[model samples]
Target: MDLAPFKHVLLLPRVRPLALLMFFARMPPAATGVILTLHVAVTLDKGYGAAGLVGAAGTIGMGLGAPLMGKLIDERGLRAMLAVSVTASATFWLSAPLMGYWVLLVCSFLVGLLGVPMMSIGRQVITALVPESRRRVALSVDSISVELSFMGGPALGVFVATKFSTSAALLFIGVSTLVAGLLLYWANPPMIHEDEVVDGPRPKIIEWMRGRIVGVLVVCVGATVCLAGMEVSAIASLEHIGKQSWLGVVFFAMCAASIAGGLVYGGVKKAPSVLVLLVVMAAFEIPVGLGDGSVLWLCLLIIPMNITCAPLIAASGEHISRLAPPTARGLAIGLQGSAFTVGNAIGAPIAGVAIDHGGAPAGFAIVGVIGLLVAGVAWLLARQRKPVATQTTMAS
Candidate 1:
């Protein structure tokens, strides 16, 4: 609806390139996700269960690796993280196509373990470059760009795999990772460190988690959980209704709504709180789950649920930027990634079991109820937040 948010952030000299770099960097994860499952199930003749385990290994690795990478970035800066991640990632991805099932399991874990820190790095750069007042816009731009990769990468992965070859898809992921690595290396976005405290005890990372930061992190996790659950349920529903082929179109529509919502969020002078947005997101999806099993009904119901997606993420990003101490921003941002990854890991499988027991509606109900519960707690935590950090920062 509005172009100012896009114009404001993109016009920045430093931000423009980093945004482009992130677009490329984000592709590998999405591409590999589809390719890995397809490779294991179709090409290697392994079943879905085995494919799920292989995928889980990578997800678990990422959940653990993101925060660790963030801590290192806080100490060493972005360049060092980029160097290690790019090399490790390139090696792991290139080798992925060659490994047998057992070896592939090991490599997936290692691949996730050494996953490129593009997301953490990109968020840290945004935090450092944008002032607090303008952070909402910056965050929205970042969220929107991420959604583009989120939507396109998997489609591309499936296309290459189906149309050509699985090996070609794997090769594409590896080559793309290599290119993304080089782009990041050249961008080398500078980190801004806080002024040193001469005599006072330095702030601890745990200290930053004292208030709204905790809420931000939890709300983000919950939002992602909903996404993962919704995805699993949608696919399962399609299969049940015998229209599974429409899966790509369904997901693509949702992604488009998210991008549109993100654009509006950035344009608005003030956006709703993360908890409120989550409530809306959770509430809307229930109807989708209860839909009369048809593609048309599913698409109609998903509109409201998809609308809130990127706006909620943008709010969480802005909240963490405000909540964390300037010095530990990278760690804070990284932890956010870790939280989302954990949600990503748990949501689908849990929903899968639910889908099996009572069909897609059951999974949808489970995830929606979970969202409502988490949003309630997030609201409580947010309300309890002391203005201590803002006051202290202002006084200084």
Candidate 2:
């Protein structure tokens, strides 16, 4: 029997109501970093340290909020959590312009706390609603949309800030978030409520945490750390070369590469295993260390590095979905999101300090080393499987 026919049945339309909702919802948060930085620079009359604090606060909020929101989705329903989060995000965005540095920090933090969970919930919903065979394609589409938003949000934020005013950028992000949230609420996708189903009661959170699911999360955290390190190092290297102007070009190229990767991933017959994907992704880091500081070389290197990112992320998502129990899927995915947020927050500062002291090449080397370490760990995890006897017992 050809597995291709089985996989074809799983492919769903790329543009669905839920995907549209997530794209818009992610825009504000995606754009916020650039706008918030500019706003702090222009309005707060503060130093880089202060701005860094504000940025850190938002990342921390995202890390804290995502898992909580996932738990909420599990306990209540998608609709209720979506409504609450949207209202919270709208309020934060509208009030952002009026706030001082401290207040802005708090507002941005809360906004991140509320904003990021929607993506996790949306992923959970899609996993439940979409057929198993088509899920990889569907998730690849979602991953591409996320990469596009990440690329566009910062650029748009910078443009609006330069053309109009910082406040104008904030206003745009605020309104976009509100609209996105409301649309998700109205569409009201089917909920995957594990609480309602009576099957020997739901597993306790602690119990659920004790298994392969946690192992998967550990690998996810490692991959995210590598990703965050590379992103920070790449930007720092560009700036050090006195080609800060090329930052956008480099980022655009990387994102474009990821988009291509995602598209290709959607059409694949047998997706690579998570371990294999991580190994491939680690290879992307070699270019970061190998490329000379030339903008052209850097840009060229980014293409291969980015080509692996989306597929790795999509594979990670697939692993998480399959391992997590139905009721805990939201929380599990939320935790996975939190891992990435935390990794980025930690990686950026370390890369910045390394660049300041050691030079840009040092930063890239650091990231490359981290990626290699993570890849090794992933390989180890792949090899150390539970015995077949245990699998048989679990199945029984």
Q: Give the best candidate by TM-score.
A: 1
lDDT for each residue of candidate 2 in 275-358, tens digit (9 for 90 to 100): 556556656665575564788888787687678678767777766766566677788889988877766776666667767787
lDDT of 2: 0.70
Please provide, for model 1 over 1-396, each residue's C-alpha lDDT reduced to its tens digit, 9 standing for 90 to 100.
567767877787688877877877887777777899999998999988899889989888888888877877777877788778888888877877788999999888877877786667767777667666677888888888888988878888889999998878988898899998887778777665233222445468656676567777778878888899999999988998899899888888889999999989889866778888888888887767866388888877887888898888788877776667666767788889988887777778778888889899988888888888888877777766444443322001
TM-score of 1: 0.93
RMSD of each: 2.9, 3.9
Error of 2 at 72 (Å): 0.6
Model 2: what TM-score? 0.89
- Model 2, position 84: C-alpha lDDT score: 77
Give candidate 1 misplaced runs (Cα > 4 Å).
193-202, 385-396
Candidate 1 lDDT:
0.79
Cα TM-score per model: 0.93, 0.89
Write out the backbone clash pairs for model 2. Answer: 10-133, 10-134, 11-134
